[model samples]
Target: MGDIEPGALVLRRAEPADRTALAGTDPIAAAGDPTRRASIRRWCEQGLALLAEDSRGPVGYGVLEYTFFEQGFLTLLTVVPGARRQGVATRLLTAVEAACTTPKLFTSTNVSNQPMQQLLLKSGWRPAGLVHGLDEGDPELFYLCPSENLSLSSTLRTFPDTVIGKESRI
Candidate 1:
Protein backbone atom coordinates (compact mmCIF):
# COMPACT_ATOMS: atom_id res chain seq x y z
CA MET A 1 0.00 0.00 0.00
CA GLY A 2 1.09 3.56 -0.70
CA ASP A 3 0.17 6.56 1.42
CA ILE A 4 -3.11 5.68 3.13
CA GLU A 5 -5.91 8.17 3.66
CA PRO A 6 -6.32 8.86 7.36
CA GLY A 7 -10.05 8.24 7.15
CA ALA A 8 -9.55 4.75 5.73
CA LEU A 9 -7.60 3.45 8.70
CA VAL A 10 -9.48 1.59 11.44
CA LEU A 11 -8.08 1.09 14.92
CA ARG A 12 -9.10 -1.86 17.09
CA ARG A 13 -7.91 -4.09 19.86
CA ALA A 14 -5.74 -6.89 18.47
CA GLU A 15 -6.77 -10.54 18.88
CA PRO A 16 -5.04 -13.88 18.52
CA ALA A 17 -6.41 -14.15 14.99
CA ASP A 18 -4.54 -10.95 14.10
CA ARG A 19 -1.12 -12.27 15.14
CA THR A 20 0.04 -13.26 11.66
CA ALA A 21 -1.14 -10.06 10.01
CA LEU A 22 0.25 -7.97 12.81
CA ALA A 23 3.67 -9.60 12.56
CA GLY A 24 3.63 -9.08 8.81
CA THR A 25 3.39 -5.34 9.38
CA ASP A 26 6.72 -5.11 11.19
CA PRO A 27 9.99 -5.75 9.37
CA ILE A 28 11.67 -7.32 12.39
CA ALA A 29 8.68 -9.53 13.02
CA ALA A 30 8.24 -10.35 9.35
CA ALA A 31 11.85 -11.49 9.22
CA GLY A 32 10.70 -14.66 11.06
CA ASP A 33 12.07 -14.20 14.51
CA PRO A 34 10.50 -16.61 16.99
CA THR A 35 11.04 -14.29 19.90
CA ARG A 36 9.32 -11.35 18.22
CA ARG A 37 6.44 -13.54 17.05
CA ALA A 38 5.98 -14.95 20.54
CA SER A 39 6.04 -11.45 22.02
CA ILE A 40 3.32 -10.31 19.62
CA ARG A 41 1.23 -13.34 20.50
CA ARG A 42 1.63 -12.65 24.19
CA TRP A 43 0.61 -9.00 23.72
CA CYS A 44 -2.53 -10.08 21.92
CA GLU A 45 -3.31 -12.72 24.55
CA GLN A 46 -2.96 -10.12 27.31
CA GLY A 47 -5.23 -7.60 25.52
CA LEU A 48 -2.35 -5.15 25.39
CA ALA A 49 -2.19 -4.92 21.60
CA LEU A 50 -3.95 -2.51 19.24
CA LEU A 51 -4.06 -2.88 15.49
CA ALA A 52 -4.47 -0.38 12.68
CA GLU A 53 -5.95 -1.63 9.45
CA ASP A 54 -7.24 -0.19 6.26
CA SER A 55 -9.02 -1.72 3.25
CA ARG A 56 -5.74 -3.46 2.45
CA GLY A 57 -5.52 -5.31 5.80
CA PRO A 58 -3.37 -4.93 8.91
CA VAL A 59 -0.91 -2.08 8.49
CA GLY A 60 0.31 -1.35 11.99
CA TYR A 61 0.09 -2.37 15.64
CA GLY A 62 0.99 -1.07 19.11
CA VAL A 63 1.44 -2.70 22.50
CA LEU A 64 0.73 -0.96 25.82
CA GLU A 65 1.26 -2.44 29.26
CA TYR A 66 1.08 -1.17 32.84
CA THR A 67 4.40 -2.71 33.79
CA PHE A 68 6.46 0.46 34.28
CA PHE A 69 6.24 2.08 37.67
CA GLU A 70 2.66 0.78 37.74
CA GLN A 71 1.91 3.14 34.84
CA GLY A 72 1.01 2.59 31.23
CA PHE A 73 3.99 1.81 29.00
CA LEU A 74 3.94 1.61 25.22
CA THR A 75 6.31 -1.25 24.43
CA LEU A 76 5.82 -1.40 20.69
CA LEU A 77 4.56 0.74 17.83
CA THR A 78 5.23 -0.66 14.39
CA VAL A 79 3.87 0.21 10.97
CA VAL A 80 4.58 -1.41 7.65
CA PRO A 81 7.07 0.45 5.48
CA GLY A 82 4.43 1.17 2.86
CA ALA A 83 1.97 2.61 5.36
CA ARG A 84 4.26 4.78 7.44
CA ARG A 85 4.41 8.59 7.82
CA GLN A 86 0.66 8.77 7.25
CA GLY A 87 -0.44 9.21 10.88
CA VAL A 88 -0.76 5.46 11.55
CA ALA A 89 1.62 5.63 14.49
CA THR A 90 -0.06 8.75 15.82
CA ARG A 91 -3.45 7.10 15.73
CA LEU A 92 -2.11 4.01 17.49
CA LEU A 93 -0.48 6.19 20.16
CA THR A 94 -3.71 8.15 20.70
CA ALA A 95 -5.63 4.91 21.08
CA VAL A 96 -3.10 3.63 23.59
CA GLU A 97 -3.26 6.86 25.55
CA ALA A 98 -7.04 6.68 25.64
CA ALA A 99 -6.88 3.08 26.83
CA CYS A 100 -4.29 3.80 29.51
CA THR A 101 -5.53 3.24 33.05
CA THR A 102 -2.88 5.09 34.99
CA PRO A 103 -2.02 8.73 35.53
CA LYS A 104 1.00 8.56 33.23
CA LEU A 105 1.88 6.72 30.06
CA PHE A 106 5.54 6.02 29.30
CA THR A 107 7.47 4.91 26.23
CA SER A 108 11.10 4.82 25.22
CA THR A 109 13.14 4.58 22.04
CA ASN A 110 16.82 4.31 21.30
CA VAL A 111 18.52 7.70 21.17
CA SER A 112 19.50 6.96 17.60
CA ASN A 113 15.82 6.50 16.63
CA GLN A 114 15.26 10.17 15.86
CA PRO A 115 12.13 9.57 13.83
CA MET A 116 10.34 7.97 16.75
CA GLN A 117 11.61 10.64 19.13
CA GLN A 118 10.30 13.34 16.84
CA LEU A 119 6.92 11.65 16.61
CA LEU A 120 6.67 11.39 20.38
CA LEU A 121 7.55 15.06 20.89
CA LYS A 122 5.17 16.20 18.18
CA SER A 123 2.42 14.08 19.72
CA GLY A 124 2.75 15.80 23.11
CA TRP A 125 5.01 13.34 24.92
CA ARG A 126 7.58 14.95 27.21
CA PRO A 127 11.15 13.80 27.73
CA ALA A 128 11.37 11.83 30.95
CA GLY A 129 14.92 10.52 31.15
CA LEU A 130 17.79 8.77 29.39
CA VAL A 131 19.09 5.32 30.23
CA HIS A 132 22.43 3.95 29.04
CA GLY A 133 24.01 0.49 28.69
CA LEU A 134 20.85 -1.11 27.34
CA ASP A 135 22.23 -1.21 23.81
CA GLU A 136 25.84 -0.26 24.47
CA GLY A 137 26.48 3.06 22.69
CA ASP A 138 22.85 3.63 21.80
CA PRO A 139 21.13 4.87 24.93
CA GLU A 140 17.41 4.62 25.53
CA LEU A 141 15.46 7.91 25.70
CA PHE A 142 12.30 7.77 27.79
CA TYR A 143 9.14 9.85 27.32
CA LEU A 144 6.07 10.50 29.42
CA CYS A 145 2.49 11.46 28.54
CA PRO A 146 0.82 12.27 31.78
CA SER A 147 -2.94 11.98 32.02
CA GLU A 148 -5.21 14.93 32.75
CA ASN A 149 -5.46 13.82 36.34
CA LEU A 150 -1.73 14.21 36.80
CA SER A 151 -0.38 17.63 37.66
CA LEU A 152 2.71 19.13 36.06
CA SER A 153 4.25 19.85 39.43
CA SER A 154 3.90 16.24 40.50
CA THR A 155 5.43 15.05 37.26
CA LEU A 156 8.34 17.48 37.55
CA ARG A 157 8.95 16.33 41.11
CA THR A 158 9.19 12.74 39.97
CA PHE A 159 12.24 13.46 37.83
CA PRO A 160 15.62 14.84 38.79
CA ASP A 161 16.06 18.62 39.12
CA THR A 162 18.38 18.55 36.14
CA VAL A 163 15.78 16.86 33.94
CA ILE A 164 13.13 19.50 34.66
CA GLY A 165 13.86 23.19 34.42
CA LYS A 166 12.52 26.45 33.02
CA GLU A 167 13.43 25.29 29.53
CA SER A 168 11.90 21.82 29.96
CA ARG A 169 9.02 20.83 27.68
CA ILE A 170 7.03 19.14 30.45
Candidate 2:
Protein backbone atom coordinates (compact mmCIF):
# COMPACT_ATOMS: atom_id res chain seq x y z
CA MET A 1 0.00 0.00 0.00
CA GLY A 2 1.18 3.52 -0.68
CA ASP A 3 2.01 5.88 2.16
CA ILE A 4 -1.12 7.83 2.96
CA GLU A 5 -1.10 10.90 5.14
CA PRO A 6 -2.70 10.38 8.54
CA GLY A 7 -5.04 13.30 7.90
CA ALA A 8 -6.29 11.51 4.79
CA LEU A 9 -7.81 8.67 6.78
CA VAL A 10 -11.58 8.26 6.60
CA LEU A 11 -13.57 7.51 9.73
CA ARG A 12 -16.87 5.67 9.88
CA ARG A 13 -18.90 3.38 12.09
CA ALA A 14 -17.73 -0.20 11.73
CA GLU A 15 -19.92 -2.39 9.56
CA PRO A 16 -20.99 -6.00 10.03
CA ALA A 17 -18.97 -6.92 6.94
CA ASP A 18 -15.79 -5.69 8.62
CA ARG A 19 -16.21 -8.03 11.59
CA THR A 20 -14.63 -11.11 10.06
CA ALA A 21 -11.75 -9.09 8.69
CA LEU A 22 -11.19 -7.48 12.09
CA ALA A 23 -12.19 -9.98 14.77
CA GLY A 24 -11.69 -13.26 12.90
CA THR A 25 -8.24 -12.17 11.88
CA ASP A 26 -5.47 -11.35 14.35
CA PRO A 27 -6.13 -7.64 14.43
CA ILE A 28 -3.84 -5.64 16.69
CA ALA A 29 -5.29 -3.88 19.76
CA ALA A 30 -3.83 -1.39 22.14
CA ALA A 31 -1.18 -2.90 24.44
CA GLY A 32 -1.56 -6.10 22.41
CA ASP A 33 -4.49 -7.15 24.57
CA PRO A 34 -6.25 -10.23 23.21
CA THR A 35 -9.50 -9.51 25.04
CA ARG A 36 -10.00 -6.38 22.97
CA ARG A 37 -11.33 -8.30 20.01
CA ALA A 38 -14.39 -9.36 21.97
CA SER A 39 -14.92 -5.86 23.30
CA ILE A 40 -14.55 -4.41 19.83
CA ARG A 41 -17.13 -6.86 18.55
CA ARG A 42 -19.54 -5.87 21.29
CA TRP A 43 -19.02 -2.18 20.58
CA CYS A 44 -19.50 -2.70 16.86
CA GLU A 45 -22.74 -4.43 17.52
CA GLN A 46 -23.83 -1.38 19.47
CA GLY A 47 -22.81 0.93 16.61
CA LEU A 48 -20.22 2.57 18.86
CA ALA A 49 -17.17 1.16 17.12
CA LEU A 50 -15.42 3.36 14.58
CA LEU A 51 -13.03 2.32 11.84
CA ALA A 52 -10.27 4.36 10.31
CA GLU A 53 -9.21 3.44 6.81
CA ASP A 54 -6.80 4.61 4.22
CA SER A 55 -6.39 3.57 0.59
CA ARG A 56 -5.14 0.16 1.68
CA GLY A 57 -7.93 -0.77 4.07
CA PRO A 58 -8.92 -0.44 7.71
CA VAL A 59 -5.76 0.60 9.47
CA GLY A 60 -7.11 1.37 12.94
CA TYR A 61 -10.20 1.58 15.13
CA GLY A 62 -11.64 3.19 18.25
CA VAL A 63 -14.67 2.54 20.42
CA LEU A 64 -16.71 5.44 21.73
CA GLU A 65 -18.37 3.80 24.69
CA TYR A 66 -20.63 5.41 27.32
CA THR A 67 -20.25 2.88 30.09
CA PHE A 68 -18.13 5.19 32.19
CA PHE A 69 -20.35 7.60 34.13
CA GLU A 70 -22.37 8.02 30.95
CA GLN A 71 -19.53 9.92 29.40
CA GLY A 72 -17.95 9.33 26.03
CA PHE A 73 -15.21 6.89 26.85
CA LEU A 74 -12.60 5.99 24.32
CA THR A 75 -12.69 2.44 25.54
CA LEU A 76 -10.41 0.97 22.95
CA LEU A 77 -8.12 2.25 20.24
CA THR A 78 -5.98 0.01 18.12
CA VAL A 79 -3.69 0.50 15.17
CA VAL A 80 -2.64 -2.49 13.12
CA PRO A 81 1.00 -3.34 13.66
CA GLY A 82 2.03 -2.28 10.17
CA ALA A 83 0.27 1.04 10.68
CA ARG A 84 1.85 1.90 14.03
CA ARG A 85 4.04 4.99 14.33
CA GLN A 86 2.19 6.50 11.40
CA GLY A 87 -0.36 8.60 13.38
CA VAL A 88 -3.16 6.09 12.88
CA ALA A 89 -3.99 6.09 16.58
CA THR A 90 -4.03 9.86 16.60
CA ARG A 91 -6.50 9.95 13.76
CA LEU A 92 -8.66 7.34 15.43
CA LEU A 93 -8.62 9.36 18.66
CA THR A 94 -9.58 12.51 16.84
CA ALA A 95 -12.58 10.72 15.39
CA VAL A 96 -13.63 9.47 18.82
CA GLU A 97 -13.27 12.91 20.38
CA ALA A 98 -15.31 14.45 17.60
CA ALA A 99 -18.07 11.93 18.21
CA CYS A 100 -18.24 12.88 21.87
CA THR A 101 -21.08 15.19 22.89
CA THR A 102 -19.24 16.63 25.87
CA PRO A 103 -16.50 19.20 25.97
CA LYS A 104 -14.02 16.58 27.21
CA LEU A 105 -13.55 12.98 26.20
CA PHE A 106 -12.31 10.22 28.49
CA THR A 107 -9.91 7.33 27.91
CA SER A 108 -7.46 5.22 29.84
CA THR A 109 -4.38 3.12 29.25
CA ASN A 110 -2.34 0.82 31.42
CA VAL A 111 0.51 2.37 33.31
CA SER A 112 2.99 0.24 31.41
CA ASN A 113 1.55 1.23 28.08
CA GLN A 114 3.94 4.12 27.55
CA PRO A 115 3.35 4.34 23.83
CA MET A 116 -0.38 4.88 24.29
CA GLN A 117 0.18 7.33 27.13
CA GLN A 118 2.58 9.29 24.97
CA LEU A 119 0.10 9.24 22.14
CA LEU A 120 -2.61 10.58 24.44
CA LEU A 121 -0.32 13.27 25.79
CA LYS A 122 0.90 14.34 22.38
CA SER A 123 -2.62 14.42 21.02
CA GLY A 124 -3.65 16.94 23.71
CA TRP A 125 -5.16 14.50 26.20
CA ARG A 126 -4.29 15.43 29.78
CA PRO A 127 -3.85 13.46 32.96
CA ALA A 128 -7.17 13.15 34.76
CA GLY A 129 -6.67 10.40 37.31
CA LEU A 130 -5.88 6.72 37.83
CA VAL A 131 -7.60 3.53 38.84
CA HIS A 132 -5.94 0.81 40.86
CA GLY A 133 -6.41 -2.94 41.47
CA LEU A 134 -7.79 -3.49 37.95
CA ASP A 135 -4.40 -5.07 37.27
CA GLU A 136 -1.69 -5.53 39.82
CA GLY A 137 1.41 -3.35 39.67
CA ASP A 138 0.20 -1.64 36.53
CA PRO A 139 -2.71 0.68 37.25
CA GLU A 140 -5.10 2.13 34.68
CA LEU A 141 -4.34 5.75 33.91
CA PHE A 142 -7.16 8.01 32.87
CA TYR A 143 -6.96 11.02 30.57
CA LEU A 144 -9.27 13.70 29.18
CA CYS A 145 -9.35 16.11 26.28
CA PRO A 146 -9.45 19.98 26.48
CA SER A 147 -6.19 19.91 28.42
CA GLU A 148 -4.47 23.06 29.50
CA ASN A 149 -1.65 24.55 27.49
CA LEU A 150 1.23 22.93 29.29
CA SER A 151 4.84 23.05 28.31
CA LEU A 152 7.20 20.10 28.61
CA SER A 153 8.78 21.40 31.79
CA SER A 154 5.47 22.29 33.46
CA THR A 155 3.74 19.09 32.38
CA LEU A 156 4.87 17.33 35.54
CA ARG A 157 3.06 19.85 37.72
CA THR A 158 -0.20 19.27 35.92
CA PHE A 159 -0.09 15.60 37.00
CA PRO A 160 0.09 14.42 40.57
CA ASP A 161 3.61 13.66 41.74
CA THR A 162 2.53 10.81 44.02
CA VAL A 163 1.81 8.72 40.94
CA ILE A 164 5.33 8.73 39.63
CA GLY A 165 4.90 4.92 39.87
CA LYS A 166 2.63 3.96 42.75
CA GLU A 167 -0.19 5.59 40.82
CA SER A 168 -0.62 6.11 37.08
CA ARG A 169 0.61 9.46 35.73
CA ILE A 170 0.72 10.55 32.11
Candidate 3:
Protein backbone atom coordinates (compact mmCIF):
# COMPACT_ATOMS: atom_id res chain seq x y z
CA MET A 1 0.00 0.00 0.00
CA GLY A 2 2.91 2.32 0.60
CA ASP A 3 5.11 1.74 -2.42
CA ILE A 4 3.10 3.09 -5.28
CA GLU A 5 4.47 3.39 -8.79
CA PRO A 6 2.55 6.23 -10.27
CA GLY A 7 0.98 5.24 -13.57
CA ALA A 8 -2.00 6.86 -15.20
CA LEU A 9 -3.12 8.57 -12.07
CA VAL A 10 -4.14 12.18 -12.76
CA LEU A 11 -3.87 14.40 -9.71
CA ARG A 12 -5.99 17.51 -9.66
CA ARG A 13 -7.36 19.97 -7.16
CA ALA A 14 -10.98 19.11 -6.51
CA GLU A 15 -13.55 21.56 -7.81
CA PRO A 16 -17.20 22.13 -7.02
CA ALA A 17 -18.13 20.62 -10.35
CA ASP A 18 -16.73 17.36 -9.06
CA ARG A 19 -19.15 17.12 -6.15
CA THR A 20 -21.85 15.31 -8.10
CA ALA A 21 -19.47 12.84 -9.70
CA LEU A 22 -17.63 12.32 -6.43
CA ALA A 23 -20.75 11.87 -4.30
CA GLY A 24 -22.12 9.44 -6.83
CA THR A 25 -19.06 7.20 -6.97
CA ASP A 26 -16.83 7.95 -4.02
CA PRO A 27 -17.58 5.39 -1.30
CA ILE A 28 -17.72 7.84 1.55
CA ALA A 29 -19.82 10.32 -0.34
CA ALA A 30 -21.95 7.63 -1.90
CA ALA A 31 -22.56 5.86 1.41
CA GLY A 32 -25.87 7.70 1.69
CA ASP A 33 -24.64 8.94 5.03
CA PRO A 34 -25.42 12.58 5.39
CA THR A 35 -22.81 13.03 8.07
CA ARG A 36 -19.92 11.86 5.91
CA ARG A 37 -21.08 13.95 2.98
CA ALA A 38 -21.41 16.98 5.23
CA SER A 39 -18.01 16.46 6.69
CA ILE A 40 -16.42 16.06 3.25
CA ARG A 41 -18.26 19.12 2.04
CA ARG A 42 -16.98 21.11 4.97
CA TRP A 43 -13.42 20.05 4.18
CA CYS A 44 -13.98 20.97 0.56
CA GLU A 45 -15.00 24.45 1.61
CA GLN A 46 -11.49 24.94 2.89
CA GLY A 47 -10.11 23.76 -0.49
CA LEU A 48 -8.29 20.80 0.99
CA ALA A 49 -9.72 18.09 -1.21
CA LEU A 50 -7.59 16.35 -3.86
CA LEU A 51 -9.06 13.87 -6.28
CA ALA A 52 -7.18 11.03 -7.92
CA GLU A 53 -8.67 9.99 -11.19
CA ASP A 54 -7.61 7.63 -13.92
CA SER A 55 -8.98 6.68 -17.33
CA ARG A 56 -11.89 5.00 -15.58
CA GLY A 57 -12.55 7.78 -13.11
CA PRO A 58 -12.03 8.48 -9.41
CA VAL A 59 -10.11 5.72 -7.69
CA GLY A 60 -8.85 7.52 -4.57
CA TYR A 61 -9.06 10.82 -2.69
CA GLY A 62 -7.48 12.74 0.21
CA VAL A 63 -8.18 15.85 2.25
CA LEU A 64 -5.65 18.11 3.96
CA GLU A 65 -6.26 20.71 6.64
CA TYR A 66 -4.64 22.75 9.42
CA THR A 67 -7.59 23.34 11.70
CA PHE A 68 -7.47 19.91 13.31
CA PHE A 69 -3.71 20.06 13.85
CA GLU A 70 -1.38 23.02 13.71
CA GLN A 71 0.71 21.13 11.17
CA GLY A 72 -0.42 20.03 7.76
CA PHE A 73 -2.91 17.28 8.48
CA LEU A 74 -4.18 14.67 6.08
CA THR A 75 -7.68 14.44 7.44
CA LEU A 76 -8.96 11.66 5.24
CA LEU A 77 -7.67 9.26 2.59
CA THR A 78 -9.94 6.83 0.79
CA VAL A 79 -9.19 4.33 -1.94
CA VAL A 80 -11.72 2.06 -3.52
CA PRO A 81 -11.33 -1.55 -2.46
CA GLY A 82 -10.52 -2.56 -6.01
CA ALA A 83 -7.84 0.12 -6.23
CA ARG A 84 -6.04 -0.94 -3.07
CA ARG A 85 -2.39 -2.08 -3.33
CA GLN A 86 -2.02 -0.48 -6.72
CA GLY A 87 -0.09 2.53 -5.37
CA VAL A 88 -3.09 4.79 -5.62
CA ALA A 89 -2.94 5.52 -1.92
CA THR A 90 0.77 6.17 -2.09
CA ARG A 91 0.36 8.49 -5.03
CA LEU A 92 -2.38 10.33 -3.21
CA LEU A 93 -0.06 10.65 -0.24
CA THR A 94 2.83 11.87 -2.38
CA ALA A 95 0.55 14.49 -3.86
CA VAL A 96 -0.40 15.55 -0.36
CA GLU A 97 3.20 15.82 0.70
CA ALA A 98 4.08 17.86 -2.39
CA ALA A 99 1.19 20.25 -1.97
CA CYS A 100 1.87 20.75 1.72
CA THR A 101 3.69 24.00 2.45
CA THR A 102 3.98 23.48 6.18
CA PRO A 103 6.98 22.51 8.24
CA LYS A 104 5.47 19.08 8.88
CA LEU A 105 2.60 16.86 7.91
CA PHE A 106 0.53 14.81 10.34
CA THR A 107 -2.13 12.17 10.05
CA SER A 108 -3.78 9.42 12.04
CA THR A 109 -5.27 6.04 11.38
CA ASN A 110 -7.47 3.86 13.53
CA VAL A 111 -5.59 1.16 15.42
CA SER A 112 -7.67 -1.44 13.65
CA ASN A 113 -6.50 -0.19 10.27
CA GLN A 114 -3.23 -2.11 10.07
CA PRO A 115 -2.84 -1.47 6.35
CA MET A 116 -2.73 2.26 6.86
CA GLN A 117 -0.20 1.90 9.66
CA GLN A 118 2.02 -0.15 7.37
CA LEU A 119 1.61 2.43 4.63
CA LEU A 120 2.58 5.24 7.01
CA LEU A 121 5.72 3.44 8.12
CA LYS A 122 6.77 2.44 4.62
CA SER A 123 6.30 6.00 3.45
CA GLY A 124 8.74 7.35 6.07
CA TRP A 125 6.14 8.78 8.37
CA ARG A 126 7.08 8.18 12.01
CA PRO A 127 4.84 7.49 14.92
CA ALA A 128 4.38 10.77 16.74
CA GLY A 129 2.03 9.79 19.55
CA LEU A 130 -1.41 8.41 20.23
CA VAL A 131 -4.85 9.56 21.31
CA HIS A 132 -7.16 7.28 23.28
CA GLY A 133 -10.93 6.95 23.38
CA LEU A 134 -11.14 8.03 19.76
CA ASP A 135 -12.44 4.59 18.80
CA GLU A 136 -13.27 1.59 20.97
CA GLY A 137 -10.11 -0.46 21.50
CA ASP A 138 -8.64 1.42 18.56
CA PRO A 139 -6.83 4.50 19.77
CA GLU A 140 -5.77 6.72 16.91
CA LEU A 141 -2.18 6.20 15.73
CA PHE A 142 -0.64 9.55 14.95
CA TYR A 143 2.13 9.91 12.35
CA LEU A 144 4.31 12.82 11.34
CA CYS A 145 6.81 13.64 8.58
CA PRO A 146 9.14 16.56 9.05
CA SER A 147 9.63 18.90 6.11
CA GLU A 148 13.23 17.80 5.59
CA ASN A 149 12.04 14.23 5.08
CA LEU A 150 9.05 15.18 2.99
CA SER A 151 10.43 14.41 -0.46
CA LEU A 152 7.74 13.88 -3.06
CA SER A 153 10.10 12.28 -5.59
CA SER A 154 11.11 9.66 -3.04
CA THR A 155 7.69 8.13 -3.39
CA LEU A 156 6.79 9.08 -6.95
CA ARG A 157 9.14 9.80 -9.79
CA THR A 158 8.70 13.24 -11.29
CA PHE A 159 10.27 15.51 -13.86
CA PRO A 160 12.44 18.41 -12.70
CA ASP A 161 9.89 20.89 -14.03
CA THR A 162 6.86 18.82 -13.17
CA VAL A 163 3.91 20.10 -11.26
CA ILE A 164 0.54 18.64 -10.35
CA GLY A 165 -1.56 17.22 -13.25
CA LYS A 166 1.45 16.06 -15.27
CA GLU A 167 2.26 12.36 -15.41
CA SER A 168 5.32 11.18 -13.51
CA ARG A 169 7.52 8.15 -14.01
CA ILE A 170 6.36 5.17 -12.02
- Per-model CA lDDT versus the true structure: 0.79, 0.68, 0.73
Better of 1 and 2 by lDDT: 1
Cα displacement (Å) at residue 89, model 1:
0.8
**What's the TM-score of each model vs. the native?**
0.85, 0.73, 0.81
Q: Give candidate 1's error at residue 149 in angstroms.
A: 9.4
Residue pairs that clash (backbone atoms under 3 angstroms), model 1: none
Q: Order of all candidates by TM-score, from best down to worst?
A: 1, 3, 2
Candidate 1 local lDDT, 24-129, one digit each (tens): 9878889999999999999888778988888889999999898898988999898888888899888777777766767788999999998899999898789999
**lDDT for residue 122 in candidate 1, whole number 0-100:** 90
Candidate 2, which ten residues in sequence have the lowest lDDT sum?
161-170
